[model samples]
Target: MTKGIQNSETPLFLLSMMMENPEAAELCFPQLLNNSCRKPLPPQSDGMLVYIVLSFISLLTVTLNLLVIISISNFRQLHNPTNLLILSLAVSDFLVGLLLMPAEILHTEACWFFGDHMCALNYVVDFIITSSSVGNMVLISIDRYLAICDPLQYTNKVTLDRTKICVCLCWICSVLYNSLILNNFLRHPDEQNSCYGECVVILNNITGTVDFVFTFISPITVIIFLYARVFVVAVSQARTMRSHIATVALQRSVKVTAKKSEMKAARTLGVVVVVFLICICPYYSPTLVGQDIEDSSSSSPFVVWLLYFNSCLNPVIYAFFYPWFRKSIKLIVTLQILQPDSCNAGIM
Candidate 1:
């Protein structure tokens, strides 16, 4: 009969050996071995400090994402097509920080305290949120491409309805990709071999190579290609605008102003793409060599921690790329500081 929960036999053996066996000569080694073949378990390596740091970072990310979401959503003037994409990204990141990270931290400590159902649900939610986040970044790239390359066409075609449709499609595609993983693959947790964490991979017949290919490699390829094209289009558009202005040779002041504005817009999109690449590369880099890692479960913290960096970055990127968010923050701060006086006036 199936136990319907992860078997910790493997980890127990590993953890036990680590804690039980201690060699002074081996203690001189720089690395801690979570998995060793020694008959006696080695000393228990406490990951409590790591978990506490991760939890703090996760809490900070959640708070920032919430502020971003609320700031964007509450400001009526910021309800444009591009900001819509930003808001979607915020929502996905917020869920990662709020819902996923806590569970992950707990699992890191307790080694999967949740049962099978919870595990499946956690995996599904994680897949959905992560996939959606990647998809949203793609959507943002396309949106910026249109805005920079074909300004007039962007104004005409990038309507609110179209933006909504794009976001909906992003989420749908994300859910579909995750669905593929769950349906074609995924195994019941092994009571002996597995941890009780949510979203723990059922490492069986399927290789990490398969997971890396479908989940990381494919999507990353798409993102890189899209951003490349977007950059090309943006550069071409900027050159075209510059040429047109040079030919017309209107007033010097007007020409300079137009050139500066064009340059500014191009620079904004450039920075956004660059930031996207930087933030996502760390998280996905492991996917390339994930199969080679000696201990997959223990190495997961590298990717998980890198992913947490991504959740925190989106808010900072928005604050940098979009001035509206900064203005909104200033407004919110000023209003909060004045609320008491306004209340007193109203009461009087």
Candidate 2:
């Protein structure tokens, strides 16, 4: 009602017709056959297979991100700045799985039954989730950079309270920024619809370019630059530790071990950043080639799904690389988390 369907009529009548005569679905809005979008053909075996795969991915995304949220939120020992940033990312990715993924599947394979205003709002939520995810990645990179490059001041510089504040700011900015990007579309939700039942948004060259640079290029450059510096400093510190190990006794050895752990964490998070870039690159290929990102309720299936797949992979990465994550998962899976004073249990 809010977005592009001022003249929508007898939606139930169309539904009843479709129920009575399956062919009635040939027109999504049968009353306006000349203008309504034609329904997609019945699914083939391959189409069914694709649906199965995408549905499974949606389920996995929700489950994995939920576990990550639970693990981070419930465990007192996991309440550090880095983990807090991760918790924020998990919340955004959880919404992606719970809302965006299903919407993608529904719109791509079938008609968009929701009105145009709903379509506009859906894309706004999608942008907020995606942009905040990128923000989280940048924050993670900065956190790693500070930890590895300036270890002595890292705890003071990146405190839990400050990180919580930054996470709140990141989400707030995402909501505001994406709202601006989609403002025109929200005002005229049906501007790009070629026919009834179509839900699409048009991004002109200028707006698309601005969005491309701000959301993609600038953040990526910062991440790569920071991680590069972190890598160089980590290498120097490793050499220093190895060279001084024989000369220094127990006290120095403890410091060296601590530095090594920080460097290891840097390397692990570096892998995550690399994976994110890889999954996301194809999504912006059009923009990289000077094309606008014209999207619909469904959008491009392959690249968009690949982007959503990144959410699923993040938890898997933690499962493999973070011992603490695995341990927490075991505790949760076995229902040990329900025990008295479980939050105080030693996880690290």
**Candidate whose TM-score is highest:** 2
Which portions of model 2 show Cα errors greater than 4 Å? 1-24, 245-258
Cα lDDT of model 2 by residue, 1-348, tens digit: 443445656768768867887655687767665688888777899999998899999999999999999999999999999889889888988998999899888877888888877888888988999999999999999999888766667778999989988999999999999889889888888878898888788778899998898899999999999999987877777787768645456545544764767777777788888999998888888987887797775467889888988898888898989999999999999999999999988988
Q: How many clashing pairs per prediction, in order?
A: 17, 1
Question: Per-residue alpha-carbon lDDT of model 1 for 1-348, expressed as tens digits?
Answer: 222323444655655554676552233111234421112223254555666678888898898888778776766566778778878988998998998888776555443434555666776787788778877877777776666555546668889899999999988987876777665333553333332222345433354456566656776677677667666765664666667644445434443553465445445655655665666566556445543322223446666667656788778766786676676666566775245433222110
The window of 10 residues in a row where model 1 has the poorest summed lDDT is 28-37
Total residue pair clashes for candidate 2: 1
Cα-based lDDT at residue 71, candidate 1: 74
* Model 2: pairs clashing at backbone N, Cα or C within 3 Å: 3-117
State the displacement of the C-alpha of residue 303, model 1, in Å, after optimal TM-score superposition.
Answer: 2.0
